[model samples]
Target: MNNNCTEVEDPYIRYVMSQRPFGWNFTDPPVFKPYEFEKVDPFYWVSLMEDNWKVAFYAAAIYIVAIFGLQKFMENRAPFELKKPLFVWNLSLGIFSVIGFVRYVPGFMLVLSQPNGFYRSICIKDGMDLPTGYWTLLFAFSKFWELGDTFYIVLRKRRLVFIQYYHHVVTMIVVWIVGPLVEPISRWYTVLNYGVHSLMYPYFALRAIGIRVPVFIANLITFLQLSQMIIGFTVNMTSLYHQQIGNDCIRYPVSIKAFSLVYGSFILLFGKLFYDSVIKSGRRQKEKKLL
Candidate 1:
């Protein structure tokens, strides 16, 4: 391997790789590698799930029906506390997200630091690198498990808001579509989601266990979610621009459109929720305090 990036013609790639941030060495060999077994690979299994669109659609259909059906069934029954179980569930997800964030992000940053790394990361197959690919595959599969979040809400007789269910449904579909594709741009979504979940789930777990977190912390988490959507939408638009210029970027027209629509709507929905729940409510409390 030449290991010399000067031959690369793309200016963007050269510029990103040359900037060493905070004394981090981008040229160092990767610390992690993809896992494999005797003649079998787990990442392949996750990739295979995306081979058929019906599988994702069917899963989404079942999810919608089950949540609504369970809601109706619970209408006549007393609400379940489920405090302990919910605590454990949230804690587990929090830990998983933390691990994912730690594992994938450094490697991605390292990749970006290499010669022509930005271009390689975006345009090359498996350009996210092996470790990222492995973790990302797991992240995709984990979305299905996260559907349990709604189950807890329903059982506790909490109101199932449209944003809650809509987030779950669309996220599942989007992860399935883009996860296996492993487009370099999709890495931004994975990293953002993992970072948010790492904080959000632990907060949920603490609250479930009777630890009273400040209200502002909850509002902060919601703000982070909204920010993630905005950033994701911005990234997709950038990718679209690169695709238009024929910059050797992987072009997934349908996936790009889906992401734009989903993230764009999420921005609006989350903005409203944040205003209603945080800003408006905080102002009311301030007025009461004054009185």
Candidate 2:
């Protein structure tokens, strides 16, 4: 790995040095112009390696404790009460999720319209003047709000599976961190995700609102989640290749690779669980009926 970084000989760097002399000032003179921040090259990224190392440690600590600790405690505890407002809150989010889904379709088409075509999946869209910073900020903030899913699950005394809760919290943090940290090649993942959530949340919302959906529809949603993971993996792989080959596509950096690996693995694991719980169980039930 090249540890060498381009020394900031740009006028901006000199001005920055004049102010702080240490090259790490976060105040006035640096003027927070949108997109004015220096392009984060991979080599310079390691400079943050030490400072941000705590994020991983904290993530791991939370995952271990939550999986082994709070989950076990909750499992053995007395059954908790289910109330009305929580349902109402979930319904509201369901509404927002649907709205988010509508936005995703157009956003995705915008991505597809690029000269590289949809399959190529470039992060920085060409010929598309779509909202960049604000959209990213919204997506990041939405992940935080998604923490409500877990809160509701706990409050209603649902069995919080390790797969479910861990994925939610960790993903919430990951999405938040990655959105601004690395300008990924395919923003379509965000849009596709919103689309899935749109359908998924409404299903939850319907359940909360006391509307029974066919079991098949729920299964279908799970299938979509798996499909989303496949698409994401494909896109990330394309981005990785294009980056390495110097195809002018945006590079996803090391952190993105780590994030995608974890995310994709979890999705695959969850898909297996869903298959076991749904299809395998159904087959077993049919066998019992025949007997």
Error of 2 at 48 (Å): 16
lDDT of 1 by residue, 124-219 (tens): 444344556567777887878898899899989999999988988898887776554446676778889999999999999999989999998999
Cα lDDT, model 2, residue 5: 29
User: Per-residue lDDT for 1-291 in model 2, tens only?
Assistant: 222224544442333223321211222121123233332242233234322434544654665565456546677676555546666766677676665555435545654666766543454534222233224345655765665566556645677777776676666656644543334443666777777877887787678767899988888888888787777777777777776776765544654575577558867776797788778978998999999
Kindly provide the TM-score of model 1 when superposed on the true structure, using C-alpha atoms: 0.83
The whole-model C-alpha lDDT of candidate 1 against the native structure comes to 0.75
**lDDT value, residue 206 of candidate 1:** 99
Clashing pairs in 2: 122-185, 123-185, 123-186
Over 4 Å off, model 2: 1-78, 127-133, 182-186
